[model samples]
Target: MRAADEQDYLDFATARVGALYRSASLLTTGDPHLAEDLVQETLGRMYVHWRHVSVADNPAAYAHTVLVRVFLSHRRRRSSAEQPTGALPEGVATEEDATLRLTLLDALARLGPRDRAVLVLRYWEDRSVEETARALRSSAGAVRTQSSRALGRLRSILGDSLPDLTRS
Candidate 1:
């Protein structure tokens, strides 16, 4: 890419970083540092593949797809154990809802990669089942089925703590 092209990409990446990192953090279970790494890798890969991606399409979505795949594939080659975002700073204490969040995370981590990916794409990214199916190389029926099962599993794991319709 030319110098002007690099500068334009840099501007675009800067503008999208916060949103991308937030998505990454959610996917990474609030691990800011790994989310930062994921964001950086996604940006670098996007920069490399910019020529193939049409300017007419949504670059952010394209980059996000790449980020999610990279994270999933990276996790697949490793163990199921998840690391934290390192110890909190001096004044930071544990979250009041830590147990609940951990329960949810553990449940999510138990899902197969595609299953977990679908939940993130559906609930976290708010993608339609069709969009998620396309992204995950599956049929819409599969996305729907998997998402339903995943939600059932999470609800089972969280039980009463999951939430109540009666609660505000």
Candidate 2:
């Protein structure tokens, strides 16, 4: 790659890496190591296709789509069934906030990858149904159905604890 092109890619990667990592973290459901690996792979792929990606309408959005695809692909691999266990270390949040966050992440972890992906894209990333359909390579109806079902599953998993957690 030319120096100018390399610089452009670098600039873009630097700006977008944090957001990609955040999305990856949620997709991985608090697995920081796996999230980091996902982001690295996403960035690596973006680098390989930077020529095409840079000129796209929205490179950041493209990068997020790549991240979600990478996550889903990783989940499809047989070896990915081996998940590491442990809670994410606490951040600067208050204890109540930490508890709520962990409860949500734990509930999210119990979901299937596609369900989790739909929830993250629709609710967390605030993507439109059409955008999520494109990201997940599914129809809008499928995305809508998945989103509704995923929320139902999440509510079931959270059960009564969610309201109690929020209140306390």
Q: What is the C-alpha RMSD of each candidate to the true structure, in Å?
A: 3.3, 2.2
Best by TM-score: 2
Could you say which candidate leads in lDDT? 2
lDDT of 1 by residue, 1-168 (tens): 988788888888989898888777667765667778889998988888776663748887777788888888777766856665443222244574565566666666566666777888898788988988887778999999999998888778767776455876
Q: Could you give candidate 2's per-residue lDDT for residues 1-168 as a string of tens digits?
A: 779989999999999998998899899888888889999999999999999999999999999999999999998884556375695943589887788889988999888888999998998889999999999999999999999998998889898767554565
> Per-candidate TM vs. native?
0.79, 0.92
- What's the true lDDT of residue 168 in model 1? 62
**Candidate 2 to truth, TM:** 0.92
Question: How many clashing residue pairs, candidate 1?
Answer: 0
What is the lDDT of every predicted structure here? 0.76, 0.89
